[model samples]
Target: MVTLNLVIPCFNEQEVLPETTRRLLTLLDGLVANGAVDASSGIMYVDDGSHDCTWALIEAFHSRDPRVHGIKLSRNHGHQNALLAGLLSVEGDVLISLDADLQDDLAAIPRMMAEFRNGAEIVFGVRHRRDSDSFFKRVSARSYYRLLRRFGVNVLQDHADFRLMSRRVIEELRGFREVNLFLRGIVPLLGFRTAIVKYDRHARFAGESKYPLVKMIMLASDGVASFSTKPLQWSAYVGGVLALASLSFGIWALSIRLLTDRTVPGWASTVIPMYFLGGLQLLFLGVIGGYIAKIYAETKQRPRFIIERTL
Candidate 1:
């Protein structure tokens, strides 16, 4: 039988965790009884240093059930790192990484396992639709996927951190030593025989979203910076355009003075280009500085996360 383990990363999810646990345990029990998975198949919740009763609840569940396990980080190390901590700590035939809010449908788990049994090394739990999200979010998400692809980050559209991977695939993933971890982009690079399972994303059961707008922006920034260098290339393109424009303008002014013996004089003409060029220079500088900051971070070689406790 395929031994399955679910790795859930959570932050401040005390309100919805009990219901999440009850539903997952019931589903796991059914999967075991139906011979779809080994009886040893279980679920693990990685506590991302939530300042709440989240850890206490996980500990309570772990004491009552061997299937329920918990990994506590020293502090909130972000969702991706917490997911990695859970995934790297386990040794199951197949490891499924998901969120504790249960937004990614649990019903899709069985379908993912079926795909795995059929020889897929990786299975993505992709959203069939995002009707529940705000219209802005929906549009932005679609655009983000396309932009990533344009920049050569082969990511599955509408897929978040919900996915399944075989033991070998997970083992291979361990070789990724970069400090900035964008799992969606990194996993596809493994070049495994992958499959996608579509499901409708559910609304969060309770509590505020762990990923707010600020965090979402940071994720997109990291995704672009980590996977592609197109931003740097675009900077070069902008510089070339600005240089050509300056040369053309210089020639135009010089020709006017030589041919007509008159000068074009306007504060608007002078101040406008100054502001525009200044803004562009600052923008490109920020992009270059971003890359330098990332290099400095990687060179330091700090631990991605620290484990405070485990169960």
Candidate 2:
């Protein structure tokens, strides 16, 4: 049996940590008993600078069970960075990442391990169904995946961070030192022997979702900006098209004023084009600005996350 380290990223998840811990411990015990993983297999929870008693609870868990370990970050570096911190700072034959919210089904862990043992470098936990999500969420998520594909970015549609990575795969991942962390897009780029285990997603067990509407939008934007430059290309294409249209319109207006007496004396044509083209230019600038911001962040070479303490 090989050693497995389960990493979970937590942020203000005090309400759900106890239940999440209980379920994970039970699942780990079963895997060990079945000889799927060694007894040394343990769960590591990374506290993403929670404001409440999350770190305190994690410390208690660690004291209660040697199998339960914790890593406290110096500040809230977001979920991806915290997950990266746990993955990079652990000792095990294989590493698995999951969410602290219990929505990522724990039952899939064993299957992922099975695939890993079968010589797969990475085993992705893909969601079979999103019945638990709201209508808007389902629609938006579907659209997001489709948009990524349209942008020529390779990413598993229903997969988040629930995945198992072999030691070598994790080692390769460490070589990627980008500050704009987007693991979902980054993992697929690491080509290797891979497998997928499908499972149904569940609703949050407790507390409000850490990723509300604003955060979800920001994450989607980051995913796109980090992976593909298609947005920039498309914006340029749009500008070219609008420029040609503006030139044609100018020629037509000149013809009407010089060759004929058919000209409208109103702000409809002038103000309309001004607002429309102005809005398009601003939109293009925003897209370009987003990429520039990511470049700026990466160029700084700042630490993705800082560890406050560990147990």
Candidate 3:
């Protein structure tokens, strides 16, 4: 049997640690006994600079159970970086990443491992349905995935960070060094044989969601910027269309004044065009600036994350 490691990123999740640990430990024991995974397999909790007793709980769990390990970041590095930190923390045959809230069904582990054993290098634990999500969340998530697909970005719909990746996959992933890392988009680009294990997304066991609307929007923007330059191309398309319209308008205006003694009203024409074109120019500039900023960040060559301690 091959070893398995669970890398969970926790951000101020003190309330859910006890239950999450209990369930994971029980599941680990069952998997070992059933020969699905080796006895040396363990769970690693990544403490993403939690300002609560989250690290304390993890240390306690580590003392109680040797299978439980922890990594404390020097500061909060967001979920994606923290997940990456966990993935690089240990050497194992199979690694799985899941959120600390336990929203990803833990019951899907056996099937995911089964798929991995059957020669699939990556197993994505996809959400078969999201009935528990709010209507706004459902709509926004659908739109996000569809928009990425339209831009030719390969990402699995209804799949978050819950998935299994082989050791080779992790090694290849380490070579991808980018300031704004989008694992969902990057993983699919690796061209591995992957399988999907469908499971229902459950409500958080405790505490509120870490990702609010603003964060979600920022994440979507990062994903788009990391994967495709379609947004920048769209700006050029808009500029071309705007230029054509302006030329046609100028011709009509000149003809009206030459053929008749009437002039296009100054405010009715100039004022509206001024505001509309100005707005479009700034919006397009912002899109261009986003890519430039990403380039700026990469040129800095700063460390992706800082680890304070580990166990």
Candidate 4:
């Protein structure tokens, strides 16, 4: 029997922790009893510095069943890094990542495992329909994926971080130590057999959504910057176009002055070009700053996350 490990990264999810653990344990037990997984199959929870009693609850669960283990980060490392920490610590034939919120269905684990048996190194649990989400969220999510693809980030169309990965795939993922971890983008780049299992995402059983719009936007931006140079290229292209436009405008102004002996002096003549040039300069600066920020972060050579305690 092959051992399977489920890596769940959680923050302030105390309200949902009990139910999430119960469901996962039931699923794992069923899998083991049915001979789908080895008796050693287990779940590992990584607590990302939750302010609530999330860590304590995980500890209680670990005490109740040795199949459940946990690691507590010293500080909040965000979701992606916490997931990475859990993945790196666990040893298993196959690994799966799920949210603590329980929005991602654990019932799909068996299906994901079956797909893994079919030779897929990575299996993404994609949401077929985000009916539980608000209209704004649904639209934003769709737009985010489209923008990612347009910017050259190879990510699954409707996949978040819920997925199964073979041990080898996990090892390869561990090689990526960048501070800004956009897992959706990085996982697809692993170049292995992959599959997707579609499921309807449910609303959170308890607590508010961890990923609000602002965080989602930040993640998307990080995904683009980490995986693609298209933004930098676009910056250069825009700068070039602006320079050309400036030259054209200068020529037109000079031509009018010489040919028609006309002096066109107004806010339109001065302010328009000034605004355009100023905006262009700011845009270039922003693009440059983005690249510089990443460079600065990398140069520090800090660990992606720090683990305070483990069980």
Question: Which ranges of candidate 2 are over 4 A from the true structure?
Answer: none
Local distance difference test values of all predictions, in order: 0.92, 0.93, 0.93, 0.90
**Colliding residue pairs in candidate 3:** none
lDDT of 2 by residue, 114-202 (tens): 88878899999999988888899999999999999999889999999999999999999999999988999999999999999999988
Cα shift from native, residue 44, model 4 (Å): 0.5
lDDT for predicted candidate 3 compared with the true structure: 0.93
**Better model by lDDT, 1 or 2?**
2
Whose TM-score is higher: candidate 1's or candidate 4's? 1
The digit string of per-residue lDDT tens for model 3 on 1-311 reads 79999999999999999999999999999999999999999999999999999999999999999999999999999999999999987779999999999999999999999999899999998999878888999999999999999988999999999999999999999889997988999888887899999999888999989999999999999999999999999999999999899899889989998999988875878778778989999999999999999999999988778899999
TM-score of every model versus the real structure: 0.98, 0.98, 0.98, 0.97
Worst 10 residues of 1 by lDDT: 261-270
TM-score of 3: 0.98
lDDT tens digits, residue span 1-311, model 4: 78999999999999999998899889988999988899999999999999999999999999999999999999998999999999999999999999988889888889999999888999999989887878988898899889888998888888888999999998898888788788888898888999989988887899998888789888888998999998889988988998998899889989999999687878798898899789878988998899889989988989988999999
Ranked by lDDT, the better of candidates 1 and 3 is 3
Q: Which portions of model 4 show Cα errors greater than 4 Å?
A: none
- Residue pairs with colliding backbones in model 2 are none
